[model samples]
Target: MSLVSLILALLVEQARPLPYRRVVFEPLSRLADTLDGMFNAGERGQGVLAWVLGVGGLVLAAGGVFAALSALNPLLAVAWNVLVLYLTMGFRQFSHYYTDIQLALRMDDLPRARQLLAEWRGRPSDGLSSSDVARLSIEAALVGSHRHVFGVLLWFVLLPGPCGAVLYRAAAVFAEHWSRRSEDPAFGDFGGFAKQAFAVIDWLPLRATAAAFAVVGDFEDAVYCWRTQAAQWPDDGLGIVLASGAGALGVRLGMPVVEGGEVADRAELGTGDEADVDFMQSAVGLVWRAIVLWLLLLLLLGLASLVGG
Candidate 1:
């Protein structure tokens, strides 16, 4: 089911991609905001309560959709899952900006790249170097990959199904969306909570991503780098992925962000060869390896279940 949905969704997304600013994303964005407004109360216990209520609503919504499909025709569940994941999954959601920034850097269009990187990241990039441009790009991609793909995949596998992925991804988007708007007093405190939640939600996938980096890159170095250097980042998993990637691509990935500048890693990341398709190649390879590893494991697990049964 997982493999089928992922493949179908990815194919559907590629063949007829939806625009990011489309009306579809707007509702999801609104849904997230509404949930946050209802739940995040600046108290730990209340926050948990909020999460419970918020997640409950989300789950109920998914169940309603699933039940409706099941009633109409069980086969329709596939279409439902496909549609849900089509909107929820895919590199296209965040990678377009990644690709654009990379292209801007490649063409030495630093101003355009800076403009773009700033908008995508909600930070100033006016003084970015090729490497700063590259580092932040990689950092964003690393985190985005987890939220957009791995985290979603994990939730889908762990919960009732892809609905879990939708829930988790929604949570992630809420965190990011809220944190970015911290200047508003109403949202200021939400950043801490959102960032914290995103970190906890992302922990498992980050490690998995690091392991994938090791498998596809300079195996020993990537592993060693991930183990040692990754812990240095503000985001534990972010640290590992970037560190392993730095070792793998031989391109330095970040300086520490301004002390306490958010969960972001880079105060003054070191410079290196410009980030390029090769880096994207390595990232793509790592992602595919993770997917293959997971699919094979699920297949074997299914086979074993059949044998045991």
Candidate 2:
């Protein structure tokens, strides 16, 4: 059942990707905002409560629906799983930005590429070079693929039903929204809770993603970088994905970039050639190959289960 639902969800997502702003996610955003207003009392306990209500409420609701439908018919449960996964998982959610940046770089339009990168990341790109843009783009693609696809699938398979996927995505959204420094001062305490919660949730999935990259790409180098450089990045979750991806691609990533006349020195990762326009395609290929590997593993497991039964 898990294998079939995942395969179907991927196919549906590939055929017709969901838009960035959709009705399904709008209510989730509003719910987060509501929770913030109601429970963000600038206290640690309030923050924990808000995180629980925000993440747990959705998971329970989805699980309830799946359970009710499953009581009626097993096919209904499968359909529900597909719908939830389709809404939650897909490469196209972030791939368009990657493709646009690649196209801009290929056309030798560094400015345009920088602008696209800034738009995708919601940050300033004042003095990013062509190499900087390429490296950041590839890094973003790798991390986004993990967050938007592999993590969701892994959670869905781990838990009883679609609830796991919903939990993973909701926690991620909450963490990203609240953990930023630009938010209201009251949210600082709240943001810490969300950030820590997401770290716990994402811990295993990030390593799983790194392992997939290692298996499909350069195993030894990916493992070496995962051990050596993953801790160098500030966020451990993103560090694992980016470090392994950099090694998988056999390219150098992370350097100082002048943003608004400030040079922010980033930790050096991987070892080899510097990133270029052409490596973007390699990154995309790496992600697809990892997806294929995941599906094959699931298929084999399903076959083994059937034989044992």
Query: How high is each candidate's TM-score?
Result: 0.80, 0.95
- Candidate of highest lDDT: 2
User: After best superposition, candidate 2 residue 205: deviation in angstroms?
Assistant: 0.4
Separately for all candidates shown, the number of backbone clashes (residues 3 or more apart, or on different chains) is 11, 0
Give lDDT: candidate 2, residue 3: 88
Q: After superposition, how far is residue 191 of candidate 2 from its true place, in Å?
A: 3.3
In candidate 1, residue 152 scores what lDDT?
75
lDDT of 1 by residue, 1-309 (tens): 656776787788778766655644567567657766776565445555555565567767886887788789866877778887777766676677878887887788888887888888878776566656666777787666666666677677777645777677666766666666767665446456555776787777777766765666667777666766666676535776677666655556666443223444453221346565456555566666766776677678778878999
Deviation in angstroms for 276 in model 1? Answer: 4.6
Model 2 stretches with alpha carbons more than 4 Å out: 21-26, 181-184
